[model samples]
Target: MPNATATPPAFRYQGWSLFSLLAALVLLMTVMILIINPDLTEGVRSAIRATARSSFVLFLLAFTASAFAVLVPSPLSKSLVRERRFIGLAFAFSHLIHAVLIYWYGQLNTEFWPGRTALGNVPGTVGYVFVLLLALTSFKSTTRLIGATAWKRLHTTGMWVLAAIFAYSNFKRIPMSDWYVLPFGLICAATAIRLMGKLAQANKRQSLQRVA
Candidate 1:
């Protein structure tokens, strides 16, 4: 029997707990959608084939979610800092999905996976590179072997690279890109707050030393 005063394991793993609940909800919705309209999913896929809009929406969602996984106040951030392998993997998955959706759109009308260039093709290449770097750092062995200091440097640089990828992608599409401002804004605001906090702490320590 568990100790009466002991907090449950779920409480301690807050990030996983939240992810589990959200995953359950997504599964339930999938089941409901499957049952209610069996062909709806395929029908939508068919529609997305000719229209790049669908992929754009999914790419945006993926970009935003992955960005939030970094910026949002969550146990996931703590897990990442602690080098939790699974959480890093989850972030990689989200970023990969975003990359795939963008790639889907890019390839929907052309043959530019590893070759060929077009007006809209550059951002896709840059975006994939960002995702690849992120995935590389996400591996447990890679992070552990590199150590936290190096990992931080790599991840911080990756964030800027990732941001540039999304920003460039959004701007390349002009009016369609305007929607990206939301996630980009969220990331920027979170970064500013974090920097401000650090500055405040430094000032506090300096004041304390002066008083002493």
Candidate 2:
């Protein structure tokens, strides 16, 4: 018989299943946005925007999962920590769609690429490089191949780079639309939460050492 005092298994979404669901929703949303807009070029642009927003949300979740799990210690936060890998994968997938749409837009609208300066492109190019690296190294086989220390460094650096890119992207757009402030504010808050969580973890370790 099951022991009465035994705790039930905590509810958590399966990793790949969660990734698949999130990815499908992103695709569905993109398709709906495209269909709703009559102009093909405009539709593609809108889809690009939509995917960017979705990717940002997913990235934030993965970025702060551990922090939330540590600071809040709720089932939901713990579940996020458990499923961070897949959530990050879903973010990469969303960005892949966003990239494809951007490319398609450039092809359809010849002026699209020419309008942006080389310097303006550097941050996005670097961000994609980090995204690709992070996604590739996320697999167990690849993580093992790289060694745990290297993997941790790479992930840590990549996340910070991506966070900076997101913040910069939104901050630069505020002049065009006040709405950009919302995402910029969110990234700032997430950054603070992550930092606090790290500090809390360090303090906990120090306390344990003192007790010892």
RMSD for each of the candidates: 7.2, 1.9
Estimate, for each residue in 1-212, the C-alpha lDDT of model 2 and write its tens digit: 88986433354456788899999999999999989999999999999989999999999999999999889887678778878899999999999998999999999999999999999999999999999999999899999999999999999999999999999999999999999999999999999999999999999999999999
User: Which regions in candidate 2 have their CA more than 4 angstroms from the true location?
Assistant: 1-12
Give Cα-based local distance difference scores for all models: 0.50, 0.93
Candidate 2 global CA lDDT score: 0.93
The estimated TM-scores of all candidates read 0.51, 0.95
What is candidate 1's lDDT per residue for 21-139, written digit by digit as tens? Answer: 43344344434534565565443333332123322332333334333434453554433334333343444444444444445545554543445547556665665675577668776
* Strongest candidate by TM-score: 2
